[model samples]
Every structure is written in structure tokens, then in C-alpha cells.
Target: MLNTWYYSDAPRTVRPMLSVMRRQSGFAEIIGDIDQENATFEARRCLSCGNCFECDNCYGVCPDNAIRKLGPGNRFEFKYDYCKGCGLCPSECPCGAIMMIPEEI
Candidate 1:
């Protein structure tokens, strides 16, 4: 056995987004279209933010049928109309993407 370590020296890449000045128009869709390379690179950034990766875990685990399946790669939506805040989604989420926020009445 020998002691050796190595890592890629290439700089990290980022997806291009609209500048704050131009985004203030509220036209929606701040992120610009990216090439296949950047798209793949951007997709890898999901885990860094605890973003939903469309794993369908919460969708299957919801007992109230509150989790709405928004199609492939679109992630999911909490159907508050049916959801009772059972805290199941957040607990079942593998990536810690689901969160529970108490509503004040």
C-alpha cells in the first residue's frame, strides 16, 4: 500500500441566471437556457440545496393522498386541500427536501 491522493483541478461551473437588475421585471424564468453539459452540471447541484430529485418517496408514503405527482422530473406538490400536516412527507423524504411549516390561525 502507498499513500497518494489526487483530485480534479477543474473549476466548478454554474448555470447562468438573469441578473438581479433585469430579473426585477418579474417576467418569471430567471434561469437562462443551458447546454446539455451545463444542464447535467446543474442537475448535480440539487443535492447541494436539499432540492427534490423526483424520487417519488413522499408521493408513495403519503397516507392522506396529499402528495400530488407532478410527472417525471417535475417533482411533487403538497395538496394542502387534502393534507393534514401529518409530518409524514418530511420524515419520509430521503433528501430532506420536504418541510413542515405550521399555519397560524
Candidate 2:
């Protein structure tokens, strides 16, 4: 297992280590390195809160038809070519899943 130590804004240095069962670390392993056991323990602490996994609720309900569906049927994509930056989709998301970021200048 790989162990990483980094500084946080709160205070002293932090050390994050990968779980014992895993052999190597990936991107998630890096981010979740802090107190592997504790982090994994906390990860399961979520309430789920009736959330949807990128359900594409916004993509399906766009009024301007700006959203584009890419990838396979299981995985869809959203294109903002004709998007007016309307807050409808973001507002309509039940799980607060979609967030509207300002387009790059």
C-alpha cells in the first residue's frame, strides 16, 4: 500500500494511506489516502439522501435542446452549444445533481 502525506488549510500535516487489502493506488487512492481506515469508515457515512447518479434530468428537460447525448446508451453526454445558461435544468434536478458553471471567456 502507498502512503501520502500532505498539508491542509486547517492545521498540521496529514498522512493518508491506502487500505491494507489493496496492492496499488489510483487517483481515488491518492485523494483518499488520509487515514485509510478512517476515511473508508467515513465514506460509508453518507445518508445517500435519495440522490441520483448523474441521472441526466437536466439533459432530458432542456428547453433550448442544447444538450447533446454522446457515448453509448448507458452513458450519455450533454452539449451546451445552444445553451442560454438558463437555470432551469439546474433548478429542476431533484438531487441537486447538475451545477451550471460559467462558460469560459
* Candidate with maximal TM-score: 1
TM for every model, in the order presented, reads 0.53, 0.40
Q: Model 2: per-residue lDDT, tens digit, 1-105?
A: 101121122333356556655636444554344566666655554433345344576677799888766645444445667788888876766555456787789
Candidate 1: residue 90 lDDT (0-100): 77
The residue ranges of model 1 lying beyond 4 angstroms of the native Cα positions read 1-49
Kindly list the per-residue Cα lDDT of model 1 for residues 1-105, writing each as its tens digit: 111121123445765788898899879788777788977765554442366767677888889999888888777777899998888777766667776779999
Q: lDDT at 37 for candidate 2? A: 62
**Model 1 poorest 10 in a row by lDDT:** 1-10
Which regions of candidate 2 fall more than 4 Å away from where they truly are?
Answer: 1-51, 54-56, 70-75
Compare the candidates by lDDT and give the number of the best one: 1
* TM match of model 1 to true structure: 0.53
User: Could you tell me the TM-score of candidate 2?
Assistant: 0.40
